[model samples]
Structures are given as C-alpha cells and as structure tokens.
Target: MATNPPSIFSDSRRKANRLRTLSLQAGISAPARFVLDDMVDDMAERLAFVRHEPEKVLVIGDYTGRMADEVLPHTASINAADLVGKHAIDLSRPFPVTGFDFVGVLGLLDTVNDLPGALIHLRQALAPGGMVIAMFAGSGSLPALRKAIYAAEPDRPAARMHPLVDTRAAAELLQRAGWKDPVVDSHDLTVRYRSMDRLIADLREQGLGNVLASPAPPLTRVGLDRARQAFMAEADEDGRVTETFSILTLSGRRSLAGT
Candidate 1:
C-alpha cells in the first residue's frame, strides 16, 4: 500500500501569508525582495551561459514581473504567477498547462510539503529538452533566529519555523524526479538587523512568514524578551545582529519522459 506524503505545510496559511506579505511589500517604496531580484539576475545569466533561447516560458512566484522582463527578449510568450493569488499557481498539484520550453521558479518551493511531487510536476509541464531553473532559501538560514527561539524556550520548545532543504537532499530529490543534466548549487547572503521584531517584520513582508502546519502559540512576554535579549547578545558593537540566508539553485532539462 502507498501512503501520501506528510502534511508538513499548511496551504491556507501559506496563501494568507503571501497575500498579506504582498500587500505589505507593495506599500513600501523599496521592498525587501533582494532574494527574488538576485535569483532573476542569476537565472538570466544562466540562460545566456547555456545559450538557451526559449520561445515559450513559464515563470512562477515572480509577482513583480521582473523574471518575465528578463525572459522577454527570448520568449515569445510568458505565463507568470505567484504561488497563490490572482494569476496564482498551486505547484503542489499537477499543472494544467504544459509544453513550455523554459520554466523559472523563484522563492516558493521551500514551503511545499510534497516537494518531490512538485518537482516532478514541473518537469512534466516542460517540453522535451526544456530547461528549468528554480531557486529558494535553503538550509543554514536564520541561525540567529533559531538560536534565539531555542534560548527563549529551552524546555518544551515550540515549532515555529518551516523546514528547508539542504544541498545534498536537493540533489537527491532532483535525481529522484528524473531531471536530465540536473545541477544543484548554493550561495549565502548576509543581512544585519537592529532588532528581532524588525527581522521578523522583514521576513513577513518578503513572504517568508510562518506557514507551519502546526503553528506554535504566541510567545509569552517573558519568552519574547528573552529571545530578544539573546538575539541582541550576538550583535556587534554597532548593535546589529548578522543573519545568513543560503539560496539554492536547481537547474536541469527534460530530454525525455523517463529523464
């Protein structure tokens, strides 16, 4: 007998978070979408490096049309959407459309509960010899935040964060999904925060808020203070704590159904 994958993520919460985050980001003059911007730039460079001139493209999770703009020169048509919203896509399920020669996904894969299924569906949505580039925040991100949470609840700690995939696991997943010429690469970016509240707000604005299936209750006042103190304890003389986000890139092509 076969069983479905564990429901590690909550789709309803994820959608709500994305909508609220998008609204919050829209109000800011300079939104915190550095990861999305960086990923689009990297995808463009990779497309040029591979000499791939795709005529039909599908871009997911690029709400600002940045990725679509990058593909405009090479693609005759571009289908763009966020994970959930107007013109949204539910990547966790099978795709309705197919035959795109290029697919670029940004920022949404990490929250998916059935990642392998999603990856396989992505491949299925591509034409033969089609290229796919997907990027997301991976493991080793938010170490400072993680440590602070632990310090705040040393005993009977709650689960407030989503699990992220590591490079090794991502490689294995790509192979399992049968992508041809699959490649997995990662890079880190460092950001400094003045306070834990600001960091949390930034995360929420960037569509990285809590989407865990079983969200923890609000931290008590004492716990929040302890967490804040612990976070600031790691701050530099300038009174800003440094945080790291590791971005993972997965690139591949689908040459055949089996591959």
Candidate 2:
C-alpha cells in the first residue's frame, strides 16, 4: 500500500471557514482587498491567448469567485473549487473531477505539502491536450515583513510564512509532473502599508493566514510590539513601509498521448 505524504497543513483546521471569510470580505471591499482580484485578473489576461474555447473548465482556489466568472464567458461551463463555498475541493488530495478541458488555479499551491504530487494530480485531471494555469505567491516575497517577524524574536524566529516556490523550480516541477510546453513566469508587486497591523489584517482577509499543521505559538505582546517597530523601521521618506509580493505563474498542457 502507498502511504500518504507527510502533512504540512492541518487537515482538521477550519480552512473552509477561513476561505469563506476571505471571499466575503473581498466582495465587501474590492479595492482594499485587491489581492484576489489582481490574481484573477492576471490569470484571465494570460488565458486570453488560448485559441480554443473550452467546453468545460475547472477552477481551483478561486477565493473571490471572480476567476470562474471571468472564465465563464470563454467556456461553456465552469466548476469552481476552494476550501469552502461552491464546489469545495482540496487540491492537496486527489481531485474529485477529472478530464477538464481547462484548469485554472489561483492562490492555493504555495502551502501544499506535496507540491510535485499536486502538480501531477492536476495534470492527470486534465484531458489529453488540456491546459492548466496556476498562480501563487512565489519566492523572494515579503522581505520587509519577514525581517520584521524575525526581529520580533531575535532569540528564536519561528516559521511565520510558508516556503514559496520560485519560477525555475516551478517550471522543472511541471515538466517532472508530465506536462508539456511548461512555462514559468514571475512578477513582483510592491505595496506600501502604513502599519504592520493593517498588513496582518490584509493577510487574514485574503485567506493568506497561517495553515501550517504545527504552527508556532502566538507571539507575545512584547514580540508583536517589536515586530510593529521593526516593520516601521523599513518605512521610506513618506513614512510608508514597502512590501513585495512575488507572483509566479505556471502554464502547461497535458500530453496528447495517454502515457
């Protein structure tokens, strides 16, 4: 018997509720909560080049539900899956649906324990010659926030964020996962924040909060205060700290040959 992969995120944790909260908050505050929107927009724009309109599309990790909405116009049908609401499915496990003509993944791959396995499953879920496009927070992101979090516990800094995938590694993973014509691209978004609290709030609102199975204990009040101060230390002349989010996008098609 094949044993399952070691877990990184807590399966029992209320991830569904967390994602639902993110979607609800995003709908109420679109501009203030632009991360989901930005991710969907970027994926939609990149997908615009596909010549063949899909017959059926599966969208994974659509927190705001806009990705499927945008793709709906280009396809006959769309099936959306997130941790909660609509067609809720966890891509970290075997996908319930298969043979989709097109698959779009937004903001979900970074935290998976078996990223390579997830990629392989995604490809397997696709019909021959079907395509997949996935986007997530990649490497070289959140330097200022990382620094602040580290400074908060100079004695022992814990894992405040999940390890992110880089462009090169993503491309290689796609190929290893048996996808053809793999392409990996990345871009950085620099957002300015007035305070650390606001940034933390934004992360929670966007469903980017901690999902680690063995997450570190909550920081003490002193540690939090230090973090806030350290974040502010990175502020520019305008008194706003800059944080960068590196978005990596991967695209590829399943082989036509049923291997």
Candidate 3:
C-alpha cells in the first residue's frame, strides 16, 4: 500500500549492470564476488524449508541473477525467476507475481525507508502457502567501533555503521506485514583490523558506508585523528581493532488462507 519513487541503485537494470561490471573487475579473484556468494548460500539454506518445489521464484534484493544462476545449475524445479535488484523497501512496482513457491530477500530490510510496507507487498505477491526468507544487519553490530567513536565524541549520536534491524522489531514487522509462522534468528561475526583505516577501506569496498538520515557531517581531519587514537587505545593485546557484525535472519510463510 505504500509507494515511492524508485532509487537509481535499486533499479534492476542498473543493479545488474553494476554487478556485471564488478564481476569483470574482480575477474576470477575479485573479493567483492565473495559477498555475493555468501548471500546466495544464505538464500539456498532458507529455501530448503519450503514444502513445495518452486516453479517460479522471486528474489527481492542484491543477489538477483547471481543467485538464480548458482541455484539453477543444481536444481531443476526452478523454471521461472524474477529479480527486483533494489532496496526491498522501495520496489518500483508491485511484484507481479502470485503463488510463487519461494521469495528470498537478503540484506535489504535495513536500507529501505518503509520496512512494513515492503513486507506487506511481498506477502501480497506470494501465492497461498508461499515462503519468504530475509536477512539484515542487527543493532549489536559494530560495538567496538561504536564505543571508540562515542568516546571520541560523546555528544554525537551513535552511528549505525550498518543499518541494523532489531530481532524483535523484525519479527513484529513480519507479522504486521501479514506473514504467518514467522521465525527469526541472529548471529554475530567479529572481524579484526590492524587500524581504523583498514576498517574504513573494508566498509567502502563493501558499499556499507554511512547513508543514514541526517547523518553527521563528514569526518573532519581532527575528528579522524581522535577516532584513530581512540581505536588504537581500545585495540586488543595483538594490536588489532575488532568490529562486530550481527546478522539477523528471518523466515515466514503466508497462510493458505488469510485470517
């Protein structure tokens, strides 16, 4: 029921083109390609729960063509596929689908402007008994960096290095979006970096840079210097800083009949 103008990044054509370009740049040894592989693996794991074989599948996030290609080579039930390679929240049009056996939304909920609306659309797009699997970054992500930044500038609001969805909040959203039998789980991955610069580079390469609403102004030279100092002070015995990434995975099925 909610609508908005499409974003350049979410447009399927643009996203596919971007992925194609990145694929070429990375060639056989591109680090960025691994991220897509991870996403595909997650989706495949979630799809394992569906009771019926999916003839038509919809993928509503980044892995688009890549995910289908990965699964298609191995599975034969997937006959038709469509991908909306944009923000799961701001789909350009209603998903023109019904009775799809499965829908996969990976790393999308956090970036959208309206999470509930997006889920509702996904529910409506599903056929009776269809399933959905989605994942997003969670609030506990980046505690070390958060602490370091807060120490450097206590007055500033906590920065969400990655838009994270609270587990409870996401489950509630799924229910509000009319999903049935929703289940949500979370896990954390802690990565170590030699310095803040290394961490920042990883963020940029992963396209996880800050895009929050009214985010703090760009980091000033002095601010960067102080942040580096704070990060160093908090480094572990091995002289490496750690950043946490909390991933929340959610799955649900649309009831055979509406309540």
Candidate 4:
C-alpha cells in the first residue's frame, strides 16, 4: 500500500492565486517582478560561471518566462512553465518527464507540503551529472509584514504567512535526497514601501501572495487601518518602511553513475 503525503496547502487555491497573479501582471503597465528577475539573473550567472552548457533544460515556476528566453539561444531545447499547460503538473508528485541535463526551480517550492519528496523528485528527473538549482523566500524573510499583520489582530493573530524553510533545513534535505556536493546560499532584498497596500500589491505581482490551505479571512476596515499604521511605525524620514526579502538558493548535482 502506498501512503500519500500530508496536504499542507490547498492545491486549488495555489492554482487560482498563480493564475490571478499572471493576469494582474499582464494588465499592469510595469509589474513588480523583482523576485522573478532575481531568479533569472541567478540562473544566467551560474550558467556562465560553470562553463557547462546543457543540451536540455527544464524550468518550473518561472512567472516571467524570462528563463526560457534567456537560455533558449544557448541550449538545444528548453521547457519552461508557470504551472499552466495542456495537462496540469503537481510538483509534489513525480514529474511527467525526466532526463533533463539541468533543472531550475523558482518560487514554487516554498509552499509545497512535501518539500522533501519534491526535492527527491527533482533529483530523479535529472540525468546523471545533471544539475538542479532552486530558489525561494526563506525563514528570515518579511519580518515587517509579519509584525504588521500580527498587530492587526492583537488578541488572536491568524495564520497570515506560510511556513518558510531555512538554509540549514534545506541543506539537510538535499543531503537526505542524496544530492552530490549540495550547496545552499541566501541573500536579502530590501524594498522600501510607502504603504502596506503597495507591499501587498507588489507581492501579488510577483506571485508571492497567500497560498495557505486555510487562509485568514479578509481584514476588517478597522483591522486594515491598524495594520497600515503598524507598518508605518518603522518608517524612515521619507515615510517609507524598509522590508527584507531573504532569498535562499539550493544547488546540487546527481551522481554521474545515475544512482
């Protein structure tokens, strides 16, 4: 008998949120795509530095499609998607295809319930000596957002943020998944926002909005005011509050022998 992984996230909600964000980006004149930009830049830098040109590459959760555009000219073939296609793909399960020389994951792994299984599946989809790199928002991210949301419901704070994986745990998971020479790196992105609404809007633009299984109810009018006020408490002289976004990247290669 086979047991299913516990469901920590709502798959339907995740899909809806992703689709909505993509629509929001298409409609906006200049969407906030800092995280997607960061992922694309990271991948480009890595490929250039390694001097390893791959024949086939697979990219998942690339919201901007920049990854495909960036690597298409260099590689023989590239497969990229933001979870939309003829058939829906659930990353928590086994991948539909395998044997890619390189795999790049951006943003999606953070909300998966079975992260360890997902990591293992990523490795399994690779050919021998294939490399995998994944980047996501980690534990030390968004302190300002958390505090403000908490302040809105002083007596009973709802689960406004998803649980984040830290570097130590990510490294350990890679080791457990049997990745060779696994490496985990983290860097912070600081953004100054004049209001909480701007911050939330930006989050949606980047496909980083809420995907929790049982998300908190909409904030009441009074609650929203309190949250905005709390967010402004930490503002600088220019009336902009600085928020930190910690991006953690995990990388490793499969064994050459295809074990």
Model 1, span 1-259: residue lDDT tens: 9878899889899889888878877898887887777788888888889898888888898867876665556336888878666677888887878898899998899999889999999998899999899999999989999999988989988998878999999999999998999999999888999999988877877898789999999899999999999999999999999999898999898986635
lDDT (Cα, tens digit) per residue for candidate 2, span 26-131: 5664535566677788877777766746788888776557765555564367887776666777776778889888888887788777889989989888989988
Model 2 bad stretches (over 4 Å): 1-4, 14-17, 23-32
**Cand. 2 TM to true fold:** 0.91
List TM-scores for all candidates, in order.
0.95, 0.91, 0.76, 0.95
Predictions ranked by TM-score, top down?
Answer: 1, 4, 2, 3
All candidates' lDDT scores? 0.87, 0.81, 0.63, 0.87
Please count the clashing residue pairs in each candidate, in the order shown: 0, 0, 2, 0
In angstroms, how far off is 258's CA in candidate 3?
6.1
Score residue 227 of candidate 3 by CA lDDT: 79
Ranking by lDDT: 1, 4, 2, 3
Candidate 4: tens digits of C-alpha lDDT, residues 1-259: 9788777788888888888888988899999999878877987888778876888888888867787776545545887756665545678778889999998998889988889998999999899999998999999899999999999999988988888999999999999999988999899989999999999989988878888888889989998899999999989999999999999999999999986
Model 1: residue 107 alpha-carbon error in angstroms: 1.0
Error of 4 at 158 (Å): 0.9
